[model samples]
Target: MNESNLGRREVLDEVELKKLNNIRQKKLNQMDSFEELSYEQIMKMANMHNEILNNIHMSRGDVYLYSENEKLELVEDLYNTYMSDFRDITLKQVVDFSKNVAGVEKSQDLLIYDWEKMYIDQANQILFDSSDIGDLNMSLDKLVGDVKSDNRKMFKTPILLYIETLKESSFYWASVEEGGSGLGFSLLKKRSPYFMSNKKGKKNWKNVAIADAQGMTTGMLGVAAYGAWGVMFGPAGFALTGGAFVWVAVESAMASALFG
Candidate 1:
C-alpha cells in the first residue's frame, strides 16, 4: 500500500482504541452504581430467627405422653402444673428454668461452617469478571450454606415442650377403682418435691438446646445477608469495606433481636 493509505489505516486504528477505552470506562461506572445498592440488613434478621428455633428443638425431645390407662396418671398432674405455672414464660425463661432444673453448668458446643470464607472467595471472582463457571460455583456454595443452616435451626422441639408443659400441670390426677365397676379418680397423695425439681431440670436442657439453635440460625443470617448483597450488587460492591460494615451492622441488629 502507498504511504498515504498506510497513514489513514493507522488513524482509524487509533479511533477504534479510543472507542474501546470509552466503553470500558462506561461499564466500570455502571458497576460502581450497581454496587451502591444495599439490602443485606433484612436478610440478616431472618437468619437470626431461624437459629433460635433450631436451638430449641435440638435440646428438647420430640414429645412427652401421659396415659392414665398405662398407669402414668402422674404425668397428668405434671402437665397441669407446667401449663398453669410456666405457660406464660418466654422461650428464654423456659430455657433458663430448664437449665436450673437440670443443673447444667456449661453451654453446649455447636458446629458452624465458614460461610464468610466462601463469600469472600466468590466476591473476588465477581470483581474480576471471572469465568461464568466460577460465579456459578460460588453461587451454589452460598445457597447450600443457607439451606443447611436454615434446616439446622427450625422449630423441631416445640412439640416436646408442649407435652412437658402439659405433664407438669396439676389437672392430671390419679384415680381409684370403686364398687360396681366404678373408677374413682383422685390426685396422688404424698407428692414429692424432688419429682417437681427433676422435671424442671429436664426443661432447662431443652431451653439450652433452643438457645444454641437460635445462635446458629442467627449466624446463618449473616451469611445470607452477605450472599444477597453480593448477588444483587455484584461482587465489587460487596467487596467494598463499606458494604462489609453495613453487613456487620445489620447482622448485629439481627442477633440482638433474635438472641440478646
Candidate 2:
C-alpha cells in the first residue's frame, strides 16, 4: 500500500478505537447506575428496616427483636409482604404517600382552597344551589355536632381525606420496607406512576381538592358552624355566644373585604 493509504488506514483505526472506548464507557455507566448499594447505604437501609419492624412489632403486641440477624430477616420478610400486596395499593395512594413522606403539608388544603375560589368565581357551575343548600347545610351541621360532641375526631375525618393520609403513610412505610436508604430516586420509583409525572400529580391533587372543598363548603360548613354554635352555647353560653358571633362576623367581613 502507498504511504498515503497507510496514513488514512491509521486515522480510520484511531477513530474506530475511540468509538469502541465510548461504547464501553457508556455500558460501564449503565451498569453503575444499577450497581449494588455501598456499605454505608446498606447499613442505612438495615437501620430503617429495623426501625419499621420495631414499630410494627410494637403496634402488634409482638416482642421487639433487636438482634442484627433477626432484624435483617424481619426486614426481608416485610419487603416480601409488601411486594405481595403491591397490587392492592393504588397509584394514587403511592403519590399521596410520597408527597407526605417528603414533608409536603397542607397539600390537599391548598388544592381545596384554590378549588373553592374557582367555584365561587364560576357560580354557574355550582351543582347544588341555595335551594338544596338548606338540606346539605343541615346534614353537615349534624355531622359537625357529632364530631364536636366527640372531641376525639380528627381533622381528616372525611373518607377521601383519610385515604390521602393513608396513602402518605403507606408510601413512607413501603420505602422503609424496601432497601431504600432515604434516597429520593427509590422512593420516587416506588410512588405511583401518575405521581411521578408532574402534570398528572398536580391534576390529581387539584381534582381531589376541588371535590373535597365542594363537600366541605356546602355540607361541611354547616357541620363546622353547628359545632361552633354548640361550643358557644355549652356552659358559659352568654360569653361564648357573644365571642362566637363576633368571630363569625369578623370572618365574614374579612372574607368580603378580601374576595367579594
Candidate 3:
C-alpha cells in the first residue's frame, strides 16, 4: 500500500458522509415521479442544452400525466436518450482511436473486472512502442459507455451520479485511483472490484484516514457545486467546518462532468 503517498486532501467525515447519502436518497425519493421535476431543477441537473429535450416534451405539465411506473420509465428514457450535444465526449468522436486504444475491443466483463488497468505492456514483445499521450487520453475518454453508443454520452446528474451512487455502492471503500472515466451508474448492482475487499483493522490506517478525509472534501465540495449545500447542509452543516462544504468542487470529475 506504500505506493508514493496515496493522498493528502480532506473529505467528509462520518456524520457528513451520512448526511450526503441521506440527502442524495431524498433527491431520488423525491423523484419517485418526474412529475415534480421543475424547469429549474432540470436545468441544474443537465449541463448541456435541452432544446431537443424541450421539443420532445412540449411542457413540464404534460410529464405528470403518466402513471407512477411510467414516470420512472420516462426518466429512464430521457436518461437513455442522446441529445447529440457537440460537447459530448462520445464514441463517434474517437472512433479512429479504436485501432490504437488498448482493450478498446475487449468484452465488457474483462474491462471492468480487471480494475480497468491500462495495458502497461503494449510493446507487442516489440521494442520501442511509440504511442503518445494523446493516444492514452483518447483510450480513456470513451471507456465509460454501457454500450457503444452510450460510451461517452451517459451524462446524468452529478448529485445522483458520482457522490450519490459511489458513497452507497462503494461503502466508503477507498480507491487509490478512480476505476474508470465514470462511465455510468448502476441502479441495480454494485460495481465489482471497486468494492472488492474490506480493509478493516489494517495495521497502517494512515492512508485510509487520509483517503477518507479527502473524500470528505469531495463530498463537501460536491453539495456546494450541486448548489444544494446551503439548502441541504443548512446552517449546521455549514458550521461543521465553520462554513463547511462551501469549498468549490471545481476539481470533482464527476461533479464537473455533469455540472460544468
**Largest TM-score belongs to which candidate?**
3
Best by lDDT: 2
RMSD of each: 27.8, 28.8, 22.4
Instruction: Show model 2 residue runs off by greater than 4 Å.
Output: 1-77, 85-100, 109-159, 163-260
Model 1 per-residue lDDT tens digits across residues 1-260: 01111000111234543453355345445542322222243233334333322332233311122122321222222223333543432333322222221221111111123433333333333323322323433553454355335443222121111112111110111112211101101111122345344534223322322333233322222222222111222244322333222333222222222222
**TM-score quality measure for candidate 1:** 0.17
TM-score for candidate 2, please give it.
Answer: 0.18
Of 2 and 3, which scores higher on TM-score? 3
Error of 3 at 218 (Å): 4.5
lDDT (Cα, 0-100) at 135 in candidate 1: 42
- Candidate 3 residue-wise lDDT, 38-78, digit = tens: 32332232222222223233433233234445533443333
Residue 228, model 1, lDDT: 13
Which regions of candidate 1 deviate over 4 angstroms? 1-198, 226-260
Per-candidate TM equals: 0.17, 0.18, 0.24
Residue range 1-260, candidate 2, lDDT tens digits: 01111000111234543453355345434432222223233223223333443345344323222343443343334334443444443333322222222221222322223433332333312212212323333443443344335433233222222222222222222223332222222323444675645644323332332332332222212122122111221232111223222222222211111111
